[model samples]
Target: MITAENLTKRYGAKTAVDDVSFTVRPGQVTGFLGPNGAGKSTTMRMIVGLDRPTSGHTTVGGTDYRHLKAPLREVGVLLDAKAVHTGRSARSHLRAMAATHGIPARRVDEVIELTGLTSVAGKRAGKFSLGMGQRLGIASALLGDPHTLILDEPVNGLDPEGVRWVRQFVRYLAAEGRTVLLSSHLMSEMSQTADQVIVLGRGKVLADAPLSELVRSWTTSQVRVRSPRAAELADRIAGDGVTVTSAGAGLLDVAGLPADRIGDVAAAHGIPLHELTPTTGSLEEAYLALTGESVEYKTKEIA
Candidate 1:
């Protein structure tokens, strides 16, 4: 598990990370989300002791990362995949990392196979593709078989198949009772992988909750209805806090009423309904709503 209490970071006169606090429990995948310049990188750096916190504290398990006797065996981290030495082969890189903490050579081989880098294990790190570099980074992180994993944009340059593999791999890790903290810009993938989310904006904690609760709190549920008597159904369902918009001759998009409630109303009025489907708000929608004002770099609209 990872815990942060009022963690803060400042560079010169600017505050990169404000007082933020959150707990990432074990046996679950927790997603970290924010727009650009939101201090997510700073926070992660602080967690791994790459940067010192100006105030408060953060810990992997119950001790600071710097204090862990065997840091690699306690927590695995992958902050940057491109930070490896350009001259070293992928296998050599993992071997070097394993040698640091007294990890055996066979464990390095195990991680290489586990991360699907077996074919390119002998290739130079500088010549590897973006996806292969990411795989190597992940292999290094898993070299020690740590109980906690912290990954930053692990799927940044992966293909569709690689993306799916990572999604499944992280979920599998969390299922084994390990703590996993993942950061990603892909909301659709995060929605499928994460059980809970902690959102940061401008160095402050904006929201932290389960994925379902966050979506429901920030977005509205909608139900799409198709019927020959669409106009009549719209008029019947129109009331306070309810909205109905016409899509076409036989379709109406409804908000503030569930499908079952609308179906009951249609049955009572003897309306011939062709379709009634409930559409819940997506994670992308909820993320946009939560971080709308927190976006630092806004693009201007083109005419």
Candidate 2:
């Protein structure tokens, strides 16, 4: 597990990360989400001891990363995939990293196969594609078979298949009672993979909760109803706090009423209903709502 208590970071006169605190528990995939310049990278760097915190502290498994006797075996981190040496082969890179911690050569082979880099294991790191480099980085992270994994944009340049593989792989790791802290801009994939999420905005903790709770809190649920008597149904359901809006021909988007209640009302009024589907707010919607004001680099909509 990873724990941060009032973690803060400052570069010169500018504050990169404010006082932030959150726990990444074991047996779960905790997603780290935020907009650009929100201090996510700073926070992660502090967690792995790449940058010293100005105040407070963070720990991996109850100890600072620098204090861990075997840091690789305690926590695995992949902050940048492109930080590898260009002259080294993928296999050579992993072997070198493993050698630092006295990890055997067999573990390097295991991770190479595990990351599906077997075919290009002998190829130079500079010759590898973006996706291949990402795989190599992940292989290095898994080299020590650590209990905690911290990945930053692991799927940044992956194809659809590679994306799916990473999604499944992280979930599997979490299921094995390991702690996984993942950061990504892909909300759809994070929604499917993460059990809980910790959102940061402008170096401060904006929200931290389960994915479902976060969505429900930030956005509303809507029920789509299609019926021949759409107008009548809308009128029937219209009351305090309840809203119904027409959606083309025979459809209506409803709010503040449950599906079963709407169905009962339709049945009572003898309204012929074709469809009544409840649509909860998506993770993307919730994320936008939460981080809308936190976006540092705003782009104007094209006219």
Candidate 3:
């Protein structure tokens, strides 16, 4: 398990991470999410002792990462895929890393096969493509078969099959009662892979909870209504903050109103209704709703 208590990182006058306190428990995948400048990378660095915190501290299995005699055996980290030596082959790179922790040569071959890099294990790191480099990084991270894993954008350059493989692999590790903390920009994949989510914005944690609970509490419930007089019904229901948008011909997407209320309004106005579907909410919508204000770069829509 990973525990961070009031973790803060500062660079001169700018604060990268501020008073961030969260617990990443074992046997689950905890997603670390944020905007471009939301300090996700900095927090991860602090967790692994790559970057020192300004005020607070972080721990892996209740011990600082730097204090671990053999960090690879206790915790695995994949912050940058390009951190390997360019002149070494994939197998040689893993062997060098394994050598540090007294890991056997067979374990290196096992991780190479496990990460699907067996075919290119003898290839030089400099010639590997971005996706292949990511695989090599994963292979190195799993070389020691550590109990805790911290991966940042693990599927950045992966294909569809590779992405699925990573999703399943992390989930498998979690099922084995290992701690897994993942960071990614793909909301759809995160929704499918992560059991819990921690959202950061403006160098602070905006929300942290189970994925289902975050979706349920942050996003607004909407009802999709299809009727002949869609525009009329929409106008009738448009009051205060209620929103109604036309999806297509005779289809209206209504928000801030329940499905039953929309049905009653249509029935009272003698409008023929074809469908009434309630959408609970989605992870993307919930993320935007929670971090909309914390966005550092805003783009104006072309109207």
Candidate 4:
């Protein structure tokens, strides 16, 4: 398990990571989400001891990262996939990382196969595609077979198939009792893979809870109801403190009210209800709403 207690960091007058606290439990994938320049990178750096925290602390297995006996065996991290040397082959890169802790050569080969990079394992890393480089980085992280993994944007440049492969791989690892803390800006990807979430904005912890709870509690669920008596039904349901949106012809989207209450309103007015279904708010909608003020917009070419 990994835990951060009131952790913080500052750069001159600006605070990079403010009093943030969250727990990443084992046997599940915990997604770390934030807008650009929201101190996510700084927080991750402190967790692995790459950068010192300005205050508070973060621990892995109840011990600080620097205090671990074998850091690689305890936690494997992949901050930047492109940090590998361009001249070396994927196999050589893995070998060098494994040599640091006296890991076996068989382990290197096993990870190479596990990441499906064996076909290009012997080729120079510079010649590899973006997806291939990501695989190589993942292989290096798995060389130690650590119990906890901290990956930053693991699918940034992956193709559709490669992205799906990574989703399943991380899920499988967490299922085996490993703690996975994934940092990514991909809302759809996180929605599919993460069990819980920790949201940060401007160096401060904004929200932290189970994914389902966060979505349920922070978002306004809207139900779309359609009926032939659109005018009378909408009139009966309107102005009762519930926010209702008309869908033109004969449809209405209901919000700020429960399904039962809508039914009661319809029954009180003797309006025939044709449809009533429970609606779920999307994770993306909730995330955007939570971090709306912190988002940094950029105009880049569409991929």
What TM-score, computed on C-alpha atoms, does each candidate reach?
A: 0.98, 0.98, 0.90, 0.92
Task: Report the Cα lDDT for residue 46, model 3.
Answer: 94
Regions of candidate 4 where Cα sits further than 4 Å from its true position: 260-275, 296-303
Candidate 2: tens digits of C-alpha lDDT, residues 81-185: 999999999999999999899999999999999999999999999999999999999998899999999999999889999899999999999999999999999
> Which regions in candidate 3 have their CA more than 4 angstroms from the true location?
229-245, 260-273
Indicate the TM-score of model 4: 0.92
lDDT of 2 at 124: 99
Point out where model 2 deviates above 4 Å.
none
Report model 3's TM-score to 2 decimal places.
0.90
Off by over 4 Å in 1: none
The residue-by-residue lDDT of candidate 1 on 1-303, one tens digit each, is 999999999999999899999999999999999999999999999999999999999999999999999989989889999999989999999899888999999999999998899999999999999999999888888889999999999998988988999899989999999999999999999999999999999899999999999999999899999999999999999999899999888999999888999999999999999999998898999999999999988889799
What digit string (tens of lDDT, one per residue) describes model 4 on residues 45-69?
A: 9999999998999999899999998
For TM-score, candidate 3 versus 4, the one ahead is 4
Clash pairs for candidate 4: none
lDDT of 3: 0.94
